[model samples]
Target: MKLYSQTFKDHKIVFIFFLFFLICQGFFSTKIQYERASWSNVPKAPARTAYVLSFLGDEALAHRVLSNLLQNFGGSGGRFVAISDYDMDTVSEWLFLGNSLDPKSEYLPFLAAYFFGASQDKEKLRPIIAYLEEVGVSGGKEKWRWLVQAVILARFELEDTDLALRLANKLASLWRPGMPAMMMQMPAFVQLGMGEKEASYQIMTELLREEGDKMHPNEVNFMVDYICTRLLTPTQKESDPLCIDVP
Candidate 1:
């Protein structure tokens, strides 16, 4: 009787330990599911620039000053703002008088591009990109942080998925020393395109085990999985992860 009781106690201890381990693992995995996306930090600009501009500069003076400069200057912040054809001993006043960067300066390129050009010309988008890039926000949250998103949003807002995808691909390509975002999400696209539900999540089983997109190292694993999930077909029943070839 004593021997049986001791053996039963040992079995109970082992089962308790096993349960504890499983519980810990579950909590840790759940914590990972709610992290934020790296792209979320950056965002698109709103259509409220006129208010901002009016608050920052003399609205009337700025407008009047902009009109004269554009007639001849082409762009406001080019190297020669003061010289009306600087050191023009052979000439006179500049036909255009755009914005300057400093308090005494103006913002012609930004103004002209944002206020007038962006709607009619896709090329106008370059200045926004260029401004972000020049300000050293190409790959970070501070400056170019939300630039790609903004570009994509612009394309989408214009009802142009083609442009949005083009911009997304470009940014993802420049994932800066890494694979394109679409490639990693390729399985999802493939699953959705081929109409597979189980296969979609199956790909996640493998990817979740590995490290995530290298370029955007800060990416949340579950979020990556979520993106893949977006591509899953809605019609299929759910099940355990399968051994997908990802072909």
Candidate 2:
């Protein structure tokens, strides 16, 4: 009887230890995952909805929330350190999801594109440009201007001139009366980048004439002079009006 009682006590103690170990293991696992999610900077839905993400799936509201979150993530101090490569990737993923929720909204894509451009991550910027290009195509004629601006940044800042020119050509074809002149001028700029100086000059000359036809001839002269002075070198050779290199 004594031996049986001792064996039973040992078994109960072992069972208690096993239960304690399981509890500790679970607690640590939950804590680690929570920390990971926190550092990831992805806003999580509440548990009452069974974490279904139904609440966050609202398009406009989700965009607003994402804007606020991005602002918070972009702030100074401790947050700056948290915005590492991994964190940036995670934030971009969140932005992508937010855009998916509100694909038609100009706010989210533009806002996220600005952030991604500042990131200087070529991989990240590609997707942003792609998304905005789709927006430019399907949304409205007005949105093409935004797409042009994004593409210009890709060309000058990111040095992705091929995509930039392609987008610039796309936007130029859709140009409207009220749209910005830069939309029409971007293809010329891309041509300059591609070492086609004469082609760019001719395009710019044509663009100046088009602007002059719009009843603002003097205003258009300043634009042409600005483009030639800043982007091209003046030469005594009138035959080659705008040379890529100084004569």
Candidate 3:
């Protein structure tokens, strides 16, 4: 009977302790749910070489995981977080790290260009633009799209036409076989935006002469019309063969 009594007491003690734990857990959970939440800055990227090595040399998996984490970091905990609230420097680092892990994946660049690139704080876009530019330059023909995106973000989002022109020029210089003709014409378009009519004319003229056969009919017509209507005076258009009969 004494042993039985002792066993019952032990069971009762465990039950009471478990009940207390539940009560405390519920209290803390309720308090935490009601507590004011603040936006947490994005964490700094880990050392690239070490991080990849730690993933058992599966760099692809490492970057994929990082990409997912970055996408979720902004909207974590079911909270609405603005892009402006992010620490762009750290975000840039994270993106760069992701790229280093998987240079071929466009996922990180897409996020850099569209997601965080939409920040209302225009200045914060600089790092993102820089990141995209690096990806474009290093990625070469296969990754030219990132550079194009960088130019767009610089021109429209940041309203920095000079920087846009510089990027456009780089993109034009890097033009390769099989690249879209429209993309090759970015420099001329940017030049026109900056009111450099002569430069734009020269670029378009060179493109038409060298790659006109590769361009679609609509693209060629668009270029001809733009050059004739926008870049040249009526007198010049009348004499220029490319502009002749161009409406």
**Candidate number achieving the greatest lDDT relative to the actual structure:** 3
Clashes found in each candidate (C-alpha, N, C closer than 3 A): 11, 0, 0
The number of clashing residue pairs in model 1 is: 11
Q: Which residue pairs of candidate 3 clash?
A: none
The positional error of residue 240 in candidate 3, measured at the CA in angstroms, is 33
Candidate 3 lDDT tens digits, 1-247: 3556657665787899899999999999988885545666797888988898888999999999999998988686668688898999999999989988888777888788767887989999999999999998895435776787788778767878999889988888787777667567887777666545665576568667756785457657866886899779999999999987796
Q: Please, what are the lDDT tens digits per residue for candidate 1 over residues 145-234?
A: 233333432343243445444544444445444333433443233324332334334444444444343324323333343434444433
Residue pairs in collision within model 2: none
Better of 1 and 3 by TM-score: 3
lDDT values, one for every candidate: 0.37, 0.57, 0.80
lDDT of model 1 at position 83: 22
TM-score of 3: 0.71
Per-residue CA lDDT of model 2 for 1-247, tens digit only, reads: 3556667665787899999999999998987763422344444423323222655545567566766666566453444532334344455556556655566555555554445545545555665566567666655535564575466456755677788889889877777776567677778778675654444444456555544465244434543553566445544233344333323
Candidate 1 deviant stretches above 4 angstroms: 1-137, 141-159, 172-237, 240-247
